[model samples]
Target: MADKTLTSANSVLLIGVTGLYTVPQQLQGFSEDDMYSMEAVDTAELKMGADGVLSAGWIPQIKTMGVTLQADSDSNTFFEAWYAAQEAAQEILYGFGSVTQTSVGKSYPLLRGVLSSYTPFAEAKKTLQPRKFQIKWQTALGVPI
Candidate 1:
């Protein structure tokens, strides 16, 4: 009974997880008419050197769900190569459900906060900035029983 479509890349991955859990609380609740229609364009002379410091970029935020399923593409390349082959191996063992262990034991407890490095790339789009978020969950009778 869970029929869903919602594409446009799933509405840009649900607006990148609601702008990565709300843009740093909306830049710390800025007010006074939001700093008078906001305009502060002096990015230190556009952050020069080293190709404008790699094009003067910034976007950081992340909170684990194993770094959002390792920046999913159905969890790191098609359900992890069909959970490591054997001819679609019972469809990746009934579509991934039981592989757990993390009290620092680590056996894919949803990839342990994406291999932990204090995850943040617009809240775990796996550190590829310029806005990022991704999600793809499928069951519709692909077994979860």
Candidate 2:
């Protein structure tokens, strides 16, 4: 019988990005129903591979540059704001530098997973707050010799 050791592995690459915006006064004018009726924009979609890897695709938009309130609730509103911020950050980090388009079809290593954190609060209120998400995987981006 052959013995094998089971060890946990952590991916080598973790990327993250972020955006910020002040809540607009116009939003206050809308009634609760109107506010809820306002369609929440779809920022990002995540896909997972059979191997338990994850990848995310998102529509790039300038308006999405900042966080926005989702609903009138301490929890939901906070969650919506945080969710947008995290997605925006991820989009920036993934789109940064000259390296873009990370997919299995491109011969890149299989994506491991897309992990994100959500925080709700006024950006100005939190002077020392961190707003970013990271991807975990094992691979390098560069020309091979």
Candidate 3:
């Protein structure tokens, strides 16, 4: 197959309510949403012999998913997903999916993650107009499906 540069063409984030691990129903992308970022685990250590010397084998770790958005006063998904997780009040299902541009779509699930962090504004600078927010989640066990 010829190489093709992939961009965020067909990216999606679906967050829903579920007590179990079932994939959530997809939702409409927020109006001000800008980007989705996934932080895949860098390495995992496994003891193995390489050239008769002990070496730590490496493997891809679960991805930490993130999405950045210009502040939207009306979208309550953030409050529902992040704050709820903080309080352990209820289970919220979230997933992020990406598709490579191809004749037939090549989709990758960056994270079927569980919401972990939400930082609305780390520093509310006067110069930083148009408030931005970040919401993050860690991959559930055996995630990135």
Candidate 4:
């Protein structure tokens, strides 16, 4: 049988105002999805004109990505500091980076973006759940091996 384990996976996040912040660990992946997922900001739409003509149009949307990391001390500290910095700076500190799923031999490019949302605190019964955040990136295309 093949080893279906995630051997080496990491998400390297590079902030514009600061520097690179590498999450040196596997992400919290969904049961029926990839480790990292990309979603469009707006879906394409089709409109019917008065003359029964179909017109399709879509806003040029820069894809957004969802990333989850273990909410350990390190992650909590780093993100807290980052959030504080962003708040103090009073500016949109965008970022760019990549996610490498070595086991699957696939990589994703994280383009210019900022942390759209972040979960500062969440707790369970004697368990530190992963911290899920959203990144609104200009582009996030998958590159298969």
Per-prediction backbone clash count: 5, 3, 0, 0
Better of 1 and 2 by TM-score: 2
Model 4: ten consecutive residues of lowest lDDT:
25-34
The stretch of ten residues in a row with the least summed lDDT in candidate 1 is 10-19
**Top-scoring candidate (lDDT):** 4
lDDT (tens digit, per residue) of candidate 3 on 88-122: 75555554434232433454544545556565443
Q: Encode model 1's per-residue lDDT on 39-99: one tens digit a residue.
A: 1222232346765553445533332222132232232333233234423343222222212
| lDDT by residue (tens digit), candidate 4, 1-145 | 2744566444343333244343333233332333345675666778999999999888667777775566553545555655777888886666666676556667777677777787887566587666676778887667974
After superposition, candidate 4 runs with Cα above 4 Å error: 1-35, 40-45, 103-105
Clashes of 1: 5
Clashing pairs in 1: 61-120, 61-123, 62-120, 62-123, 66-114
The regions of model 2 sitting more than 4 angstroms off are 1-110, 120-123, 126-130
Clashing pairs in 4: none
TM-scores of the models, in the given order? 0.16, 0.19, 0.51, 0.66
TM-score of 3: 0.51
lDDT of 4 at 82: 57
Q: How well does model 2 score by local distance difference test?
A: 0.31
Against the reference, the lDDT scores of all candidates come to: 0.24, 0.31, 0.47, 0.61
C-alpha root-mean-square deviation, each candidate: 20.3, 17.5, 5.9, 5.0
Give the per-residue lDDT digits (tens) of candidate 2, residues 1-145.
1432222121122122223322211122112222211123556888899999999998643211112232333333433553565566654222111122233212122122222333344345334332322232223234321
